[model samples]
Each structure stands twice: as C-alpha cells, then as structure tokens.
Target: MREPRIGIFGGTFNPVHIGHVRAAIEVAEALGLAGVEFAPAARPPHKSGDPLLDFALRLDLCRAAVSGIPGFSVNPLENERPGPSYTCDLLADLARTRPGEQFCFIMGMGDLLCLAAWKNGLGLGRLAHLAVHARQGQELEAFGRFLDHNAKAMGAAPTADPAVWSLPQGRLMQYVPVARLDVSASDIRRRWQEGKRIDGLMRPSVLDKLLTHADALPAGWGRPPAA
Candidate 1:
C-alpha cells in the first residue's frame, strides 16, 4: 500500500489571507498531497523586530480561512511547543508522530532562496520533501542552480529539469507553479491600519474577526509610514 502524502505549510499566519489559501490549494493539487496542515508558528526564528498577533488569534484565523476546504486543517504544534519555532524541529516531530507517511514542506520561492540559512536547513530535506511554490514571472534559475548543487553533493546526477531534484536520504525537492498574488500579510495589515479596504486580500470571515477584535492588537502592528 502507498504511504499517505502530507504537506506541511507553516507560517506566522498573523491573519490568514486568500493568497495563503490559494497557494496551499495549488501546492496540494500539484503534489497530490492527501492533506495540507497549516501550522502557525508560535515564534518564528526568522521574524524579528515586530511582535506577532496572539497565537490563539492566529490559529483561529487560520481555521476560519481554511474552513470547508477539503483536505485542509490547522496544526497548532508550534504554539504548544516551548521556545522559538524552528522548521527543522517541527519536521522532526511530524516524522516521529506520522511514521510511514510521506511528508512535504511547502514554501515559497523566497523561502527556498534562504533555505540554507534556516536552522538545521541542510538536514531538512532528509526529514521531508521540499515543495517550493514558484510565483508567476519569478525567476527560478538561481533556485535551480542551488538544487543542482545539492543534488551533486548528494551523489545524484543533476538534471536539466528544475521542477524536481533528487536529494540524499530518499528525499526530493519539487517546484510547483502557482498563480502570483500581489498580496502580503504586511501589506494587508498596513491597509487595515490606514483604514484602507482589503476586500479581496483575505477571507471575509478572517477579516470580520480581525475587525471584531481590532482594538486588541498591539500598537503599530503594521509597518510605519515611509519617511
């Protein structure tokens, strides 16, 4: 019997938006994942300077955003764990709990470019496949080169195809194409702070919830206006 394929989609998800939902759908479909778990980080090691929304609020928004979506659910592992949330640790925990399942870490092109900089990034491939989502018109030649170098390091023959690469320890790296959305969480927050409309950027349920609790957010959660 074939092992169940699962995609791990992790993010701060300060307020889950449509762009995030769309990317998850695209990646899950492209990779034929049995399900996609949206893991909200309790404290992202990479993100500093600004404070994130409360973990409970972020998880609630995520749940609302993915509601009714087949094969989509929110995972609060990071929130429950102590200390900084690292992808490597989460991957390891998932491997331990879900043995015999094929795990894929879904990320964006920007994240792929900085994978090596991540905590224990080199060993991440061994824990799960890297499913990178390439936005429309984004140049991926650099990513392809990085994958090729890793493939060669793993003693695997490099291929011309940039979509998939063989890695050490029975892992794989795949690039999945997805529609580019100009929306970003920072931008969404900024718009909200400035009393601007963010109609299409996020789900109505999420936006409504945020609106209902706007007063509770930290002071100046969004970026400050340019000088």
Candidate 2:
C-alpha cells in the first residue's frame, strides 16, 4: 500500500483566517492528503516590518483555528529553531523525523514562481512534492504552461497526467484547483480596526483569541481615516 501523504502548508498566519482554513480543506480533498499541517513562521525572510503579530500569539491563533478540526492541526516546527524559517529546511526536518510518510509542501502559484529565490529552493523537490494551489486573478492555462516550461528547463520528463509534473530531482509538482475566497488577512485586519462586523470571516474560537490580544496588534493596522 502507498504511504500516507501529508500536506505541509506553511505561512505567516498573522492570524489564521477563514480563507486559509477553507483552502486547506479543498486542497486536502484534491490531493488525497491525510491531513494538512499549518506551520506558522517564526521569522519569515521575505516579510519584514510591523503589524506582523508576535510569534507566540500567531502560533496561538493557528492552534485555535485548527482546534477540533478533523485531520487538521498546527505544527510549531518553524519556531523550534533560530533564524529565518525556510520551507526547504522545514521539509527536510519533517522528512528526517517522520519516515515512511510522503510530504507535499503546499503553496500557491505565486510561491511556486518565487521558489527559485528561496534557500535551497530548487532542491525542494528532492525533499518532497510541491503542491501549488490556485489563486485569484491568474490564468490557469497560462500558469500550467509556465509550469511545463519550468519542468522542461529542469530536464524533467513529461508525464501523461496534466496536473502532475515530474521533476528531474525525482519528485513531483502538482497543480491543485481550490475554491477562491474574496477575503484576505489584510482585509480582515482592516475590518477589525474599523470596528466592522467580522463574524463570518473566521472561526469564533479564533476570533475570541484575536479580540483578546488585539491591543498587541500594530497600531498602523488600527483605525482608518474618516471619509
């Protein structure tokens, strides 16, 4: 029997919101993943500045968001080590610690495009599969062609499966289609600052944590100018 495949979805969950949760669900179903692990970044090399919540609090929100959700949980592995938390290192660590299981690093099309710039980025396929999910405002066919072009450049042979691209590094890059939501973390934060109703934007449990620690959020994310 094939080993169980797990989806490793890492991100700066400034505060885990609905879109993040829902997308993970859809991606899990699409890829037949056993579960999705949400790993919050301790210090994202790409991200720098305020309004990014403290690591502990962001970790708390991630825990709340996935609490009691079947086949969904949080992984604090990124915070386990010092310095910038790179996906390559995360996947390698998981591979080393958890044997007999296949891991697919879940990311969006944008991340895939930027993968080459990441630390040990090109070698990610050697560690595990790359699952690139859909995003809004990007042409699917164009992106598919782009992936094909990239795969060719890497000297990876083509497969009959259109959704799966086999990398020469002996792993795969999969394109997963997921439902797109109009919501985002920035919008959610903005609404909160404006005292807008954010009832359906996330789980009640997550909202509870957000409200309790809201004062810790950067003031720049607070209140908008009067119209």
Q: Return the TM-score for each candidate structure.
A: 0.90, 0.88
Task: Record all residue pairs in model 2 with backbone atoms less than 3 Å apart, i.e. clashing.
Answer: none
lDDT of 2 at 48: 71
lDDT of 1 by residue, 1-227 (tens): 66767999998887689989999999999888999999998888888657678888898889889889999999989977789999999999998987888888998888877877889776678788888887865656766777765554433344567677776666677878889888899887777677677887989988888777776664527543543
Superposition error at 90 for model 1 (Å):
0.2
**What does the lDDT read for residue 160 in candidate 2?**
83
> What digit string (tens of lDDT, one per residue) describes model 2 on residues 87-175?
88899889898987898888877777787788977678778877888864455675567666665445455568777778754667777
Pairs clashing within candidate 1: none
Candidate 1: deviation at residue 223, Å?
10
> Residue 200 of candidate 1: its Cα lDDT?
79
